[model samples]
Target: MRLVRAGRRAFTGNADVLADDDHRAQVTDYFADLVRPFGAGPVTDLSGQSYGEMAKALVAEVVPAAEPVDLLVLAFSIHDVWPGRATATYLSHVCPGTPMSFAVCDQGSASPFTGLRVIGDYGVRRALLVVVEQGALPYESAAATPLAHRGVAMLYEEGAGTRATEVRQYPDVVPEAVPELARRGVAELSTGHPGARVVLSDSLAAVWPDHPDHTRVPAGQPMTGVWWHLAGASEDAVLVGDYDRDLRYLCFAVVAADQSSVD
Candidate 1:
């Protein structure tokens, strides 16, 4: 499948508009027990962007109404303020195709890569991949959170084009093994696509193989960093990659410009 269209948006302020009093109370109670052990109170402050709302805004700009998708995947790391809602199902109904949709999470930054792999493995005619990150937490831990709220939507479809998107992921990759593994992965991905530009996450850049054509995404957006850059990439062939230190996952996606649209 080839990436046909892509768009992204950054969200600000709280998502209180999306939730009601009952919804907020339920979420607060749900996390009350979990935060007690940390000496933290229940999450009464619901100040984060809703994934459902963020995805809808992106879909509006990226996915065309005439070209409905068969699959919709939402990938996220940070929990949404309105977690009680079934966001994926809601998106499926609002999206043009009424496609089968689901959310992928607890995979750190690799969630989007995993979602893309699923789409390719399923051989769907058209699919929409939504990657989102919010900047709020009910209970605080040592884990890294997004500096800001952001989301990216990419529309992929089967087309008569030589440039197809490919996803690669390696699990249980320790820091010591990153340089070599990353080198091989990049070389393999760049074999056919000449002059492939490499976009690396901040963490990956520290251990990545030195490439003259590489650009490092700003830190703090663990889930959406690489994808945010991918949306604006100008290169015909670009390799977006990141290392999820918490999950020990090394993931990469090779996306090339849609040749069908080229004159």
Candidate 2:
């Protein structure tokens, strides 16, 4: 499948549009009991963007109505404030073709890579991949939240003479072993694609082998960092990667520009 188009949006301030008395009470109670063991206080803030809302906006912008997708995948790491809602199911109804939609999460930043790989495995004629990150947490935690809300939507279709994406992931990759493993992965993915640009998440860049053309994704937006950069890449062939420190998964994808769609 080839990536034909992509679009992204960033949200700031309060996301109070979806907030309601019942939703807030439920979210507050759920988080309160969950964090009580850690001595964390009750959830006082429930202002955050709904993944459904964000993904819907992105779908409308990137995927044309005439070109209905066969599949839609939503990937995220941070929990949405509106947690109880079945976001992926909601998206399927709104998106064209009423595609088979689902969300991938709990694997940290590897979620998107996993989602992309799933789409390829499905052998669909067309697909949509939505990656999103939100910035709010009702209770305090060890994990860092995104600085802002962001979402990216990519349109992929079966076609020739377009940029194709191939995803690879390695699990339980400790920091000490990342350099060697990443170097080998990059080398394999870059083979025959001369001048392929390498884009790495900040954590990956620190341990990655020295490369003259590699670019580092900015910090703060862990889940969306690499994908956000991928949307803006101008290279004909590019390799984007990220290492999830908490989850210990190293994920990468090579986008081969001018390559025929891979079946």
Candidate 3:
């Protein structure tokens, strides 16, 4: 799939009613406790923004082209379980005359990558992929990582815009495979853009090689991989990889918009 336009929004709005000052304080304490156990820094703030609101903000940032979107695909983290049809239903309202809508879940942090595959497989002329993480509240199993509210929306077309050259997954998810998988992924990326570097996920920061040409997206935001490669960084093509221990999945992709071809 090729990228047409991309927009990102980070919410710093009111804390969720459930995450009131007192509750947030408790969450902060828990966050600190998990820091030693989890080895990730505490997530400081929990945004109160609803998923629908953040989705709207993200879409508003994109200046739509003359072409109508053929499909809208929503991708989110496991922390967001608002409802089964919440996203499709809300987006249908926001996007009247919607052609089609769908949501990708159950892949956890890898849902966005799956959403990209959906765009490619659907063969749509134009599609929208929106991914958001509103800081998983301090539920029983949610406080292990730091928290932050961020959303990213990318428009894709079949043969136009920035091309996502390759999206693949490896079966190795053990801690030891991180460096080898990441190294191999980046090496594969270099086949096309020989000078290509990488943007490492925070999870593999410690094990990955000390490359002077890599950017490590911080731990908190789930979709940082997409945001960093598409909107933030200037790499001609970037290799983004993340490992999910529970699922034993290692997902990575190489995306480029600079008219470069994977020859």
Tell me the TM-score of each prediction against the true structure: 0.92, 0.91, 0.74
Candidate 2, residues 99-217, lDDT tens digits: the string is 99999999999999999999989989999999999988778766678888999988888756544778879999998898888877887777756687888998888766664367888
Worst 10 residues of 1 by lDDT: 254-263
C-alpha lDDT of residue 108 in model 3: 66
> Which candidate number would show the highest TM-score if scored against the true structure?
1
lDDT of 1 by residue, 150-241 (tens): 99998888766454788889999998898888888888888878688889999898766563367888888998999888888777878988
RMSD of each: 2.3, 3.1, 7.0
lDDT of 3 by residue, 1-263 (tens): 66656777677755344355775566556655655565555445543446676776676675344556788888876543232237656875675236488778777677877877777888877778888776555334443543667778877667654445577676647877777776776677667666555666766675555543667777666555545455555555566676666556677777664333211
For model 2 the local lDDT of residue 68 reads 95
TM-score: model 1 vs. ground truth: 0.92
- In model 1, how large is the Cα lDDT of residue 61? 87
lDDT of 3: 0.64
- Relative to the true structure, candidate 1 has a C-alpha RMSD (angstroms) of 2.3
